[model samples]
Structures are given as C-alpha cells and as structure tokens.
Target: MSVLKGKKILLGISGGIAAYKTASLVRLFIKSGAEVKVVMTPASKDFITPLTLSTLSKNPVFSDFYQEEDENPIWNNHVDLALWADLFIIAPATANTLSKMANGNCDNLLLAVYLSAKCPVYFAPAMDLDMYKHPTTIANFHKLQLFGNQMIPAEKGELASGLSGEGRMAEPETILDFLEKDWQDKLPLKGKKILITAGPTYEAIDPVRFIGNHSSGKMGYAIANKAFEWGAQVILISGPTHLQVNYPEIEVHRVTTASEMLESCKDNFESVDIIIAAAAVADYKPKVVSEQKIKKSDLEIDIVLEKTTDILAYMGAHKKKQFLVGFALETENEFQNALQKIEKKNLDLIVLNSLNDTGSGFGTSTNKVTLITKSFEKEERPLQSKEAVAEDILNKIIQNYEV
Candidate 1:
C-alpha cells in the first residue's frame, strides 16, 4: 500500500555532483507506483547523461523546447509539460537554478516549465561546503524559502569540498519519505490559508557582520511542508535558511530582520487561517551601526542594543478568527514561559522546546516538544525527526480546527 501509487511526478534534474542520485530516486518513485518523468537542464547532462535517466524513467528526457528535427515535428511544449504532473521534484538544484527560480528568471525550457508549473514543486540542492556556505548561496536559499518552496534540508556529511560541513543533498530515501506524505485522502486543513515564519532572522551590525542564531528552520519548514501536503494554501514567511520552496499552493516571502519579518507577517496575516511563528528572531540589534568596518581601536566599543518587535504579540492583538501558533525555546522555566505566551499571544497552541534538552533544540535534526494549548494542557513527546515533529503539530491543529 504505497502512498505514491498512481501519483504522477516530474523529476527535474540540474547540474551537480548529486545528479547521479536521481537514477535511483526515479526507481524508488516507480517502485512505489508513481509514473515518473524526467526533465534535465543542459548543464545536468554533464553530470548524469539524459540517456541514463531516460532509461530509468522509461520516458523521453526533456531538455530543450525544440525537439530533435528528425522525422518528428512535435516539440517539447513547456505549457503542456507544466500541466502533466501531480508534483515536480527538482534534485541537485544548483545555485544558479535556485537563483533563477528565486527571481522568476525564465531563460530556458526548464525555467519556463518551472514558472508555469501549477502543481506542487520540490527542490533538493547540492553543492560544496564553501559554495553552500557563501553569503550569496544563503541569500538564494532565503529567497526560495520565502517563495513558499519545500526544501529537503541537506544532510551533513563529508563533501566533495574536501572539508566536513553542511551542503550535502538529502538522500533519495529521505526525499521519498516527504514527497509521499501528502497522499492521504483526508484534507484536514483544506482551503485554509496558513502562514509560517521559520529559520533564523539576521540583525545587521555591519555590512560584514550580523547577529544571528542557530535556527535551522527545520521545525518551521517542516510544519509548512506538511501543511501543504494536507492540501492547505500555505504562505511561508521565512528567514535566512538553506532551503527551497515546494507546494504550488504555498507561497513564500523572505525577510532578514525583525522589522522585515513583522512587515511580511502583517501583509499576509489577514488572509491566513492560521499563523505559525517558529522563527528565531534576534532579540536585540546594534542601536547605531558604523557605515564601514570599525577599525580596531584601543578604546572599548560599546554597542548599544535595542529590543526587536515581538511578531506574535503584534499579530495577537490583531488576530481574528484565524488560529495562531507560536514556538517557545527557553533555557529555564520552560513550561511557565510557554504558558505565558499561550495566554499573552492568544495562541491556540504553542510548541515548547528548551535549550536544556539535548536533541530537541538548536540545529539538531531531531526534536522533543511539548504541545501546549489554551487550557495549558501539555503533551510531552519524545525526540523525533523535525519532519515527524511537524506532523505532530499539524495533526493537533487539524483536530482543533475540526478540519
């Protein structure tokens, strides 16, 4: 009983070392009963030839809009291609392809198809440690997250970069797990507009430096991704994170600072059926930033700090019938603080995490959470993958909303 039985998926492959993984990914999709189709970028051919993918998918690989002019006038029409899938999975989404998707740059058939895709869109990025860590790459990631794309967080492993760090593409099995999660018949939050804020927001101190936290956006992005799988119209207003967008029904907006996040939240809050504030926004920022890099001086530099606006409180005051959710990451008195926020922010439910818990908080792949509701009833759960934790949250929401 595979969830993907009869599902039609369009697998988009780009130029990257991890492109080789798609061959097996296609096989997994097919074995699970999905009708898999392949779309390759011109650069993708350099890593894994289209012929190989064609053989695996058992369908013609689409590269250019113009079909070969040998005995057939039929072209690879981007318009028709966009409508041919229940989902689109773009693996090994190189930095260039991500940036193009971010800015809606349609220069080729792949870009055109992506732009025109009315179905769910998924991207898996692969790159070296340095390129993945570059500021531009981080910024592009933020762009995709804000665009409401679903991102499969890269696994940490030895990379082609010769250095050990973050940048590896997710394993094919992991991607398959998330891709088919939405196959259930029940649409609990169907037609509801939910907005999720995720990742770590940056507070600029200088052009070269910013105050940030270790929010992987894992929890929030997982919530956003799962919500879309349930057929909700999700708008993910995210901070800076190395993630890509997903659901065609989900739109994303990116922000970097407390102010930027607040602004984006307010813009979308009115139309939302629910709002989840899972981002780790900076608590303070330099009151006055020096225009240029402050040269080393013998004098002690005192950076006056100011508190950032609390997004949850702001929305709480303006909230209507829409359900509101908040995340509390505490170091001490965790339950007390979470209870206060549930009342203070008028949240229907709040997810509680403590820095004290080993696997639950910070940048870990797993989390232990306590779900607190309006009556202060709590459900303490053991550690699980961020993806599973997200499902737990959504399940609670669905039960509450009776969707």
Candidate 2:
C-alpha cells in the first residue's frame, strides 16, 4: 500500500524475547513503502543482533553515541535521529523500558530520542503475564496516554518462555496493519466532536403530498464526510434523504419531517462541539395534514399553513459553547439574506447560494458559493464539485479556529 509511501518510521528494539521478530517487521514496513531505521538497546542485541535488522532495513543500526572499546564504533547524533523520524514506534517494549519512558529517563539513545520526538509516538509492550498485569505497569500505561502517546496492546498467546499468556508482542502482520491504518487516518479534528443536519425537511399537506425543496443533500453529506476524515466524531441528522453514509466515523439518524429532524438535532446539541445547519426545512406546514389523500380536489384549493420551528434560531437561544454554521439559499438579495441569517442566528459563518446562477444550486453535483463571515466579509468562488467545496469549507473552518 502506498499509504505509507515516503513515510519515515523509527523502529525501536528493546530487550525482550520478541526482539527476534524485528527483522520481519522491518521488512514489512519497507514493503509498504516506508524508510525504516532500527535503534536497538544493548540488551536487545543479545536476542537479535543489529546486523539482522540492518540487512532487512538497508540501513546501519545504532544503539549508542559512545564509541566501543578496543574497536571503536562511530558516535551517532541523537538530535539528527530524533528529527528524522515521522513516527517513533517502540515494539517489544520491556517493563524496564516502560518505567524509564514514563519517568523521562533518557539514559540511552532510544530513550533520548523518545524524549525529543515531536512526531506521533507509539509502543507495543511485551512481557510475562505477571509483569503485564502489574499495578505499576498499568499506571505507566496511563502516564504515556496523558502525554498523547498511542499504545498497541500486546496479544494473548504462547510466550517464548513456555508460558501462554497475555504478554506476547502483537504479531508482525497485525502491527503492520495497525501502522498503516494509523498513518492514513488524518486527525486534524481529533478530540473534537460535531453534529450536522442535512437534506430537505418535508411539511405534510396530505397523506400523499408534502412541501419540500429540491435539496439533494449532496453538499451536506460531503461536509460530514470531510469533517469525519479530519478526525471529528460526527452525528448526522438528515431528513428524507436516500443517501447512505460511507464512513464509520459518522452516526446517521434518518428522519422524514422538519419536526423529527429538529428533535434529533436538539437531543445531540449539547454533546456536539460544532453544529452545521444545512437542511432546507420548510418555513410553513399545513395546519391540518389530512389523514387520507386529498382526491378529486376542487380546481383551486387552499391549504392553511402555520410557521414551522426555525432550527438555527432555536439553537442560538439554547446554545452553550457550540460553534454554529448556517446556509442561505436565495434567488434575490443573496448576500444580504445570508448576512442577515449570520447575525440573527449567531452563526460563526454562513454559506450563500444564489438561484439566479444556473448549475449552482439544488439537485446539482456542482455548487458555487459565497462564504460570508459574521464580521461581514465575503469570499466568493466559482462552481465546483460538492466534495471540493466541502474541502474548501473545512479549510476555512480551520483558518477561523486559528484566528
């Protein structure tokens, strides 16, 4: 997989019986299009020598900066090594190494690099059942998590010492898959959660008829997918759309009417970090929806209508700390109408769609949008695929957060 193409991985080998597996892991990473650098501890060399790993990785392995006695080895620079790694992974980590890492003890080249790494760091611990279950080991694991380090839990299987238990280093194949998945899952919005509303909400006129827009929910689904790829946990509440969410990162709640969509959104509002109100909900609903289909109607018929709940405005009043975004589709006074919604609903940003521009509105794969901020500044762009527009909108949200 080119997923790890041009990626640099630092494979740290600590003292463990599982150190013998490093050769296979190194080859796997290389096959997956990654540059592998092996860093072994002195004790680790007893189980598997650096020569075995160096041949597989096609790079010299280094354990320390000090020169050897009688036959001196060249000193390796820790700073250069630490800066070269895109991800530092310590597989077959021993309990002793875990304690040292947790305590910030940088006595070795590997430990020093671990302390200095600014990139993502991961570890796979391996030991006997007793050590893995120890209270101290559990505490150390938590300490690493607090520092934002990722841990690959060891598998339960036959150990080298003839004990079948929960401390075997995860298999080379499993670890390789984990590395690839972690490398590809972008986390720009990590630790942030969001809720979104999409599609056209129907207002029932009779058993067989309703009032709704031509909204395809394409733009909204694109936004949700992009947000999820950026690492946000998304809850999508949609109304009367045939769309199927293609990502596991999003939780979809399908509804039929404006009221149902609003209720679902309200239920998830507090837990969400941001809210995108993109659904085209009817402003008015027939006061009395006939139980039966209206058949053989008169030449001219009038249906009494009542105001539907304004989703965004209702949110503005009940909002605590959630960031809100809205959309305005208008045939005339587009910018003005969008700006008014931005101010009235307390939205951080509003996207304006003009009906006057052909191929730029509902039921189309393309959209030309004007992003109007709460500050009254406008940025307009030409029509593009809904996915590209979603990317632009996500980037704008990132910029807004930075500002």
Candidate 3:
C-alpha cells in the first residue's frame, strides 16, 4: 500500500499556466488513498475552475475567507486548516505568490494558511525560464528554504512560452513518488510487528444466549489504525464488533468466545514484537452450555460459572522479548486495581479507564485514560478522541519500549 494512505494533504494552487496540472495531482493523491483539500488563489480560478478541483478532491475548494452567500457569513479559520494538514503542497507557485510567501504577506487566505501552517511545506515553482532564473525569484526561493520550506525543483520541459527549459511543475506521478519516499524514511515502526486484541469476547452459554460486555472495539481499532500509520505490521485479533480494518498492513482475526480469542492471540504472540491485550475478555463462562435455548417456563434457573483462560497472563508468562501491554477498566479503586493487574499479569504497561469519568468508558468516541507502567510511573490524559488516545499509548510504547 502507498505510504500516503490516510494522510491529510492540503494542495495550494496559484495563478500559473501549470495550474491545470493540479487536477491530475489531486487525482493522484486521492487515488493513493489520501484525503485531499484544495485551497486556490483567486487568480488560479481564472486558469482552472474551483469546481473542477473541488469535484476531484471531494472537498469544497477554499479561496475567500468567508461564505458571503449566507445571511450570517461563516469565517473560514486559516489556523485550523494549517494545523489540520499532515503536509501542505503548493503547486504551480507563481513568482508573485512565492514573493508574497517569502515576505510574510498574507493578502489571500491561501497565503494566510501558508504563514500559519505548522506542518511541512513543499512548493513547486512554475514559470518561464527567464522569470524562473530572475535574481528576485532565486532570492525568494532561498528565503523560503531558510524558513524550512522544501522546494520540488521545477522540471525541464516544454513551456507555454514555446521555450523548453526548467520551468514546468513536476509531474503528478513524480511528486507522489517523492512524498512516498520521504514519508517512508520517517516511519518509526517500519519493521516492527504488533499484536492487539480488541472488543469484548462473548462467552457462549447457549445457542441463543451469551455473556458479553458493552465494548464497541473503538479503542482497540483506533490503536490498530494508528500503529499501521506508524508503519507497523499489525495483527488485530478482534472480538465480535462491527469495526473493520481498512489498512492493508493490518491482518484481522475475528472471534466471538474468550477461548477463541485466547487461541488466536497465542497463535500470533510469538511472531509479534509488541502485544496489547485490549479486549474485555470475560472472566467467567457457563460451565454447562445447553445445545438448545433454555425454556422460559422455569420458576428459577441455575447456571454454574467457571474461570476463563487468562490470555494476558499466559502471554506475559511466556513472553521473551515482546513488550506486553494490558488494559484495566474499573469502577472503583481504579489506580490500585490497574497497578495490581500490571503486577499480576507481568505487563510492561497498563491503560486504565474509569467509569466515573463522563464521556469515557465503552461505546463512546472519547476517552479519559491513565497510563501506568510496571515501574509505578503514571501519566493521566484528559478526555480526547479515541484516535488521539491511541496515538498517545503508541507514543509511550515507542519511547520506552522500542529499541
């Protein structure tokens, strides 16, 4: 799969003959599985219509700061756009725009976004050879570079001026290649393998009834996606949940019962470098399961319960070089219970989620968590999206465990 998959790419188009090339560039980015957002200079709309780029990108192209068509016009916040992007690319950057960017001139919304962006910025300059070689253009290029902007050097090709020499924007395919190579080199978990268990395991009591928790598998799936983005080969052993793994790097094994989940984890445990037991495996299961559903006529019913397999403890005991992580969901004594689990399971780290916190716990998109280590270190994180929480957990693991 392409490294650009799931990336947020902000494509900035300026007034130039090569502005038309941005259509192909947006298509390439989308084809590579990236979310592309186009921001065009007002003059760029004259060369290529915003409708064309917007349709291809599947996002409304932004040029003006506000929507004047509405009774109460909404302001398009440039800072938010700047912070939202994974990378910003300015294709067909004209000398006028380049000069404005280098001099910190924020005349247009595009320029304002450029000035505020915290992510990496790349510019592809396009103009006639004479204009491209001008002293002012050269100075602006150097200034932008000194400010940490990467220049995708204009290619030598046939120009609109009927002169052919180093003034055309790089081809869309070439630009894509450059981005993929650069991102690949920066992936921290490129060669690592991660095994994650997620969702609630259902312990079957009968054909029609089972024991299960309210776990929606959001937390675990979020972790799996984040790990895949970091270039790890992820083995997501998930319980019965509606969640789906979209990344090619993630191999998912779906299971329903606690026994099935345990077997799945054991099968993949030895091959993985990191193991995260995030699944809410049932502790007890009915000892005697009826082949047929229990009749409702009984005045009272009795079902014997027995302990289920401890997957985390089993993996922890058998661990060699793998970093074992566990999760503790508690309603009381959260920290103590989590710490006890870490010691009993021999986990390298444990994530604690308490039901006391609003907007946390199962079936929610947000989470409030406390990360505890075997060494008694604790870090508390406020309520955040599950995806952000997943990234935090992975960051801790990478910092302390990854060699």
Candidate 4:
C-alpha cells in the first residue's frame, strides 16, 4: 500500500496547460487512499473546469475568495483549508503563482491558502523551457526550498510551446511515487517488522460446539492498523475474529485454536523485531473432541480436558533478540499478576487489563490498561477508545525498542 494512505492532501492548481493534469493527479491521490481537496487560481479555470474537478474529487471546488449564496457572501476560510491539510501540493505552479508564493503575494485564494498553510508544501513547476531556466524562476525555486517547501522537480519533456526540455510538470504516477518514497523514508518504523496476535482462540469440544471468549479483536486490529500507519511491516495472527483491517499492508494469519495460533507465531517470530501476544488463548481444551453432537441426555456430561500449548511461554523461552510483550487480564492483584507474567513469560513489557474496570476488557470499544515493564515500573492509562489504547501500547514499545 502507498504511504499516502489516510493522508489529507490539498492540490493547488494554477493557470497553465498542465492544469489539465491536476484531474489525473487528484484521481491518483484518491486511489492511493488519500483525501484530496482542490483549490484553483481563477485563471486556471480556463484550462480545467471546477465542475470537472469537483466531480472527480467528490468535493466542492474552490476558486473565488467567496461565492454568492442567496446573494450573500460566505467567506471561504483560507486558514481552515490550510490547517485541514496534512500536505499541500501545487502542480502546474505557473511562473506567476511561483513568484507570488516566493514574494508573499496573496492575490488569489490558492495563494492565500499556501501562505497560511502550516503543513509541508510541495510545488511542481510548469513553464516553457526559457521561462523555467530564467534567473528569477530559478531564484524562486531556491527561495521556496529555503522556506522548507519541497520541489517535485519539473521533468524534462515537451512543453506546450513546442520546445523539448526541462519545463514540463512531472507525470501523475511519478508524483505519487515521489510522495510515497519521501514519506516512507521519514517514518520511524519504516524497516521494522512487527508481529501482533489479537482476538480469542476457540477450542473445539464437538463438531458443532466450541469454547471461546468475548474478544472482538478490536484492540489487536487497532494496534495492527496503527503499526502499519507508523510504517512497520505488520503480521497479525488473529483467532476467529469478525473484524477486518482497513490497511492492506498488515499480513493476517487466521487461526481457530491456541495450537494453531502458536504454530503461526512460531513461523514468523524469528524474523520479527517485536512480538505482541494479545490473544486470550484458552488454557484448556477437551482431550477428546467427539465427532458426533452429544445430546442433552445426562444431567451433566463430563469431558476430559487438557492444557493447551502456552504460546507466550514458548516465545519467552525461545526469544533471541525480539522484544516480546504479553497481556494479562486479571480479576485480583492486577499489578502483581502483570509483573509475574513479564518475568515468567520473559516479556519485556506487559499490558494489564482488569474486568473490574468499567468500559474495559473484552467486547468493548474502550479499554483501561496499565503498562508494566519487566522491572515492575508501571504507567496507568485511564479508560479510552481501543484505538487510543493501541497508540499508547505502541508508544511504550517504541520507547524501549532496540535493534
């Protein structure tokens, strides 16, 4: 998946023949999973219509400072548009617009938004060969870069003036590739591999009956999503969850039993830098799973049970350089139980969840957790959405991550 996934990108269009290309650019950004809004210079409308852009972007196109509604002027807030963007890109940045940007000339709404923007700004220059190589235009490029704006260097190609040289704007595909590479390079966990286990495993007692917990896999899927967003290559081992992840970057392995989950973890454990075992694996399974359904004939039918494979302990015993983490859902002595699991399971960190805490535990969207290290140091978090809890857990892991 593109690193631009979930990013809010504002595309600025200026008057140039290349303004026609912004339509393709917007489509490409949307395809890469980015939210796009377009702001066009008044003169740019001659090259591309606002209706065309609006239809493609599925957002109202903005050109004038204000539009008449009921014959009343409703201001288009430039600051809000600037602040809403995670990134701003000006493609077909004509000489006129580039000069205005370099010299603080806010004549149009696009220029006003650019000047007000707090996010990273990128400009793709488009002009005739001679105009692009002019001393003033080159100076503007240097000035913009000095102001921390990135330049998606204009490609060498045929220009509208019939001259073949470095003046044409980069192609839509090239711009997308450039953005993804630039963003990925700066991510903290760009090259790291993370293995996370989520949901509750099911142990079969009969063909039609099984034992399972109330785990909805929300917490684990949240972590997996966040990890991928932070640039980690994620492998998620889920145990019979109905939840699905939005990011395709996360590799999912589905399992039904604790034994199956363990084998899946074992397959990827050696190659990963970190492992978070959040699954509530059943401690016991029926020793003999009946092939046929057992009818309700007896008052109580007794089935022999045996201990399931301890996945966390197995990882603890076999870990080499991996930073292993475990979760402990406790009813009493929460802190002590969590600390004990840290040492007994050879975990570097453990997350403690209590059934007593309202809005926490399984089958809920919110969670309250105490992050405990092997040294017994604890950091307690108040009840919050599972997404926020996931961020906290990943942050703690990142703080202590080495190698």
Q: Each candidate's lDDT (Cα)?
A: 0.85, 0.86, 0.92, 0.92
Candidates ranked by lDDT, best first? 3, 4, 2, 1
Per-model TM-score, in order, reads: 0.57, 0.59, 0.87, 0.88
- Model 4 scores a C-alpha lDDT of 0.92
Candidate 1 C-alpha RMSD relative to the actual structure: 21.0
Model 2 Cα lDDT, one tens digit per residue, 307-394: 9899999998788878788898998888778878887898888888888887888889999999877788888978899888888777
| Model 1 per-residue lDDT tens digits across residues 230-335 | 7778889889998875555568888889899999998888888888889998888888877888788899978899999888898988987888888999999999
Whole-structure CA lDDT of model 2: 0.86
Per-residue error (Å), model 4, residue 131: 3.3
Instruction: Write down the lDDT that model 1 would get.
Output: 0.85
Ranking by TM-score: 4, 3, 2, 1
Against the true structure, whose TM-score is highest? 4
Model 3, C-alpha of 163: deviation from truth (Å): 2.6
